[model samples]
Target: MKRRAFFLKAGLAGLVVGNQGLTSCAPGPKLYGDKNFYINKGYQAIPKLKLSKDRIIKETVGLRPFRESGPRVEKEMLNNKTIVHNYGHGGSGWSLSWGTGNQARNLVKTTDAKKVALLGCGTVGIATATLLQESGYDVTIYAKDVPPNVTSNLATGTWSPSSRVCAEEKATPEIKANWEDACRFSFRRMQMSLGLNDIIDWGDEYTVRKQKPSGSNISGGHEMFHIDGLNPEWKTLAQKDHPFKADYVRRRSNMIFNIPSYLNFHLNNFLIRGGKLVIKDIKSLEDIDALSEKVVVNCMGLGAKAIFNDEELYPISGQLSCLVPQTEINYKLATDGAYFITRKDGIYLGGSGIERSWDTTPNRQLTEKWVDVLSDLMKDMKG
Candidate 1:
C-alpha cells in the first residue's frame, strides 16, 4: 500500500488529504475485520496520539545535576557550622528525594542544633525540610526559586533512582548500598502518596524496539542494588499482543509524579507544620555563614558547584515537549530515542540528553524530531 493511503486507512492523515480527496472516492460500506479478526479479539485498541504543532502545550528544558561519585549525603563542618550536604541527585532527584531526605535528617538529628537551615527549595530541599519538621526540628528554607520555576518541576516525573545518578566505575560497594536503601525507602514513601490529589500513581510503561535487545543493551544496574520487587516485574509481549509498530515490546509498571501537584502538596504540608521559607540566593560561603542556624542542610543541586567548589557537579540538559492531554491514553511509551507519558497536565514527549550542558532553552528542532519519531511509530498502528 502507498504510504499516504496507509496513513489515511489508519485514520491518521485524513486532514492532510483534504475534502477534495474525500469527494473523489465513492461512498461505500465501511469494512470490518476479516481474516485476522480473531487475532485482536480481546485486545484493546491503542488510542492514536493527536500529534501536531497545534496540540503542543509547552516546551521546557531542565538541567539534571549529575555527579560522577553519586549524591553526597554526608555532614561537613565549616566555620563552626555543621553543613549537611544533600545535593547532586541528577535525574533521580524526585525518585530518591524521600530516601535522601531521611539520610539528611539523620545527620541533622545527631546535631544539638534545634533549628535547621535548608538551602534550595527544590525537591530535595523540600523533602529534607518536611522530614526534619516532622522529626521535631524547626526548619527554614532559603532558596532562589520554588515550585513552577524550580528544576525539579521540569523533570519527566518518573521513578528513576539510578538514571545518571553515578557512573559505572563509581558504583562502589558503599555507594550501591546507600543507593539501595534510598531506592527501597523512596519506593515505600512514594506508595504513601498514591491517590493523594493524584500527585503520584502507578502506570504501565511499554518499551518498544525495532529489534530484540541484546544482552549487552540491557541495563543491569538496577539488579546490582538487590532491592527485589521495588519495581514492577517486566513482561515481554508477543508481537500480536501489543499495539506498537515494533518487533519487541516489554511492559512494566512504575510510579509517576504529577510534579506541580506533588510539589504543592509537600510545600503546603511544610507550611501547615510551621516550616518557614525565605526567598534568597546563597552565592558564596560567606552567605552560608550568615545564616542564624548552626546546622545547615545544603540541597542547592547544580548551584552547589560554585558555592561549594564541587568540581564534580555538572548539568545534563534534558528537554520535554508536552501536548494536550487525552484522558484515555494513560500508559507510557518509550522508543529508541524518545518517550511519551500521559499525565494530568499533558502528554509529555521527551528524549534529549545532552551531557554537561547548562543551557535551559528549549530546542525547536529537537521537539520536531520527537514528533516525527512518534508520528512514524504510530503510522502502522491499527487504531
Candidate 2:
C-alpha cells in the first residue's frame, strides 16, 4: 500500500479508529492457518493516529540462510592445512555471528601466533576478524563480496538466532548446549550494541494471529522453543493490554538490526582496526587454506556446501520482497509461512515453506502473490 498499508500488513501498525470508535476496523495482522503461532514482534508498532495519515509503501524478501543442524563451528582441513570452519548458520547468522565467532576464536586459544587469515567477508568473517583483532591478532578478511554486497546484508536480522534451526539440530546434548550458549551470548551481545543504530537496538515486532489459519498461513509449529532461554531481547505483551485474546500477542524490546547500516559500520571500521579485505574466489578448500595465514574460519553460509563439500549444508531457500521504508512503524511479524516487518529501507514480507526450492531468482510474480496474501490477511484481521 502506501507505506501504512504495508506496515499494517507487516504488523507494524495496530488497530486503527474507523467510522465507529475502536470498532471492527482496529488494526491487526492477518491469520492464514489454524495453529498456535505467536505475533512476529519484528515491526515497530504504531498506534492509530487521530490527527495524522497512514502509509504502506514497500515490500521485500530474503532467504533464511538455511544449513542443516547447528552452524559448523569446528576446525578441519584438506591437504593438511588448518581450516577453522565456521559457517552454516541457516537464518540466524546475523543474530549469532559474533557469538559463533567467539567460539571459533576460542579454538585457536593456545596458538602463539599474532596474525590470522580469515575467509569470507560476510557477517561471520567480519565478526571473526573483529574478535581476532580484539584478541591482539592481526586479521585479514578474504572473500568476493564485502559488507553491503554480502549475503549478511540481505538479512532482516534480529536477536533470535535459532528461529529457523533445522529439526535435526537438537540431537546431541553437547551440540544442544552449544546452540543454547550461542543464542544466549548473541542476545546479550546485541543488547550491548544499542548505542549505535548500525549494530543493534530495541524495536517492536508484532505478530497477529487468526482464529483458524490455513495453508500458506502461519504454521504455529514452534509451540516449544528450546535454547538457553534466550528470549528475544524484547518485552512480552501482557494479556490486559492485548488486542486479541483468540490470537495471543506479545511485545518486547528485542534486537532489530538494519543490515546496510551495520554492514557499512563494519566496512568503515575494519581497516582502521588493521583488518584487511582480500577480494577473490576460492573454488576449493586448498585455495582457502593457502590464502590465509595461521587460522581460518569458514563462514561461507550457503557457500559452505560447495567449498567444503558439505552435503548436509543445503539451502533452505527463502525469498523476501522489499518496498520503500516506513519509519512510523518499526516491528516484525511472523505467521505460519509468512512474516512482515519494517526496517530502515523497506517493509519486509516473507512466505515460503517450499523445502529445497533452488529457485534463487527473484520472481516478481511470486512476490506479488506473497504481498496479495498479506493484504488479504489485513482484510480478514480481527478486532
Candidate 3:
C-alpha cells in the first residue's frame, strides 16, 4: 500500500504484471524508459509540507453525495410543489456545480413559478440560485448552514469531473452524454472565471512516480476529452526533467478553487443579485411543502438522503488538513490517495475518503495518518 496500493487507489497506475499477466488496474500510467517526454530538467523540488497535528488550523469533513446513476436532476411533484432534485453529485459537486446548476435552472424555467426556492446553501445551492436569479427569477436559498460552514467549503476544489461520480457499470450511453454536457459546461464556466484572483486559478499539477506508467485507463468514468469541444493540456514529463519522486511525471492543467475565497465570491454574487438566505433545517417532504415558492431546487448534499429517502444516496466522507502558507511552491501534487494544493488561505493536504461515514468531527488519528503518509512521500521524493 505504500506505493502500489496508493497509486492504484488514485487511479494513476495503469496496470501491473500479476499472476494474471499484465492485467489493468488503474487509469493513468507513468511507464518508464521514454526519453522524449517533456519535463523541466531544472525544475525545483517542492518543499516538504509541515504536517504536524498543530499545523492543522482546522479539520473538516464532507459527505460527498453519491448516487450510482449520477446526480438526480429530474423533477417531481411533491405536495403541489414542483421539486427539482439536484443533489448526489458525489466528489464532483464543486466541479460540476455550474453545469448542474444550469440543468436545474432549465428545469425551473419549465415551471410557472417566478419565485424559486433553493434548498441547501452549499456550492450547488448558491450556484443554482445565482443562475436562476440571473435568468430573471426571484430566488431564495434555505439551509441550516451556509458556505465556509458547509461541506462545499471542505472540498479539495480541484476541477475533476468524474471522480467517483458513478460506477462504470451504471453509466449508460445516455448517462455518459449527460456527463459530457455537464462536464463541458462546468469546465467552460470555470474558464470564464479564471481572472478572479485567488478565488479561481489555473494550476500546474504533477502526478509523479518512480516507474513509468503502463497500460490504458482502467478506472472507468466519463472522460472529458471524449467530449468534442473539450481539449486537455496534459503533458508527459520525462524522468530527467521531472523533479519529484522522479522516474516519470504527468503534468496537467487543473482549475483549482481557493475554497474560502471562491465561496465568498459566490455568496457575495448571490446576495448582490437580490438573493435571500433563510436558515432552515428541512426534515421531511412536508417541510418542503411549507416553503413560499412553488418550485424548489434541492442542493442539500448529503441532507437529501433523509429528506428524499433516497436509498442510493450515501456519503463518501472526506477529511482535509492544511499547513501554513508557502509562496515558494506554486504547483500541486497527487500521489497515492493524498493530494496537495496551495491556496492563499493555506496549503491544503488531504487523503481520506471513508464510505458511508457520517462523522463530521475531525479524527485525530486519521489526520495524523494522512500527514505522516504525505510527510513520508515528500521524504521519498528525489531532487
**All candidates: TM-score:** 0.87, 0.76, 0.83
Whose TM-score is higher: candidate 2's or candidate 3's? 3
Off by over 4 Å in 2: 1-65, 212-229, 232-246, 379-383
Question: What TM-score should be assigned to candidate 1?
Answer: 0.87
Clashing pairs in 1: none
Question: Compared with the true structure, what per-residue lDDT tens digits does model 1 show for residues 1-383?
Answer: 69978877767556657765876784965546542221242545456677887788899999999898999999999999999999998788998899999999999989999999999988888988999999999999999888989989899998888887887788899999899888888888888888899999788887888888676535322222345676877799887788667888888887778889999999999999899999998899999999999999999999999999999999999999999998867788888777898888999999888889989899999888889988888776654
235: Cα error in model 3, Å? 2.1
Q: Which stretches of candidate 1 lie over 4 Å from their true place?
A: 1-45, 215-226
lDDT of 2 by residue, 1-383 (tens): 59887877656334433335555666866655432233333342243111111233433344445555667888765564567778877767787787888898888665556677787888777777888888888787778777667777766666656656555535466766787777677667667667785556566666655544554323232321355335543344554454344354545555677777877786668788777878878778667657647566676777777777788776666666675565555666664446765677767666664555666676666666656665555444333
Model 3 accuracy (lDDT, Cα) = 0.77
Runs in model 3 deviating more than 4 A are 1-54, 212-231, 380-383
| TM-score rank order | 1, 3, 2
- What is each predicted model's overall lDDT from 0 to 1? 0.85, 0.64, 0.77
lDDT of 1 at 101: 94
Q: Candidate 3 lDDT, tens digit per residue, 124-186?
A: 888888889999998888999876688888888877787878866888888788877888888
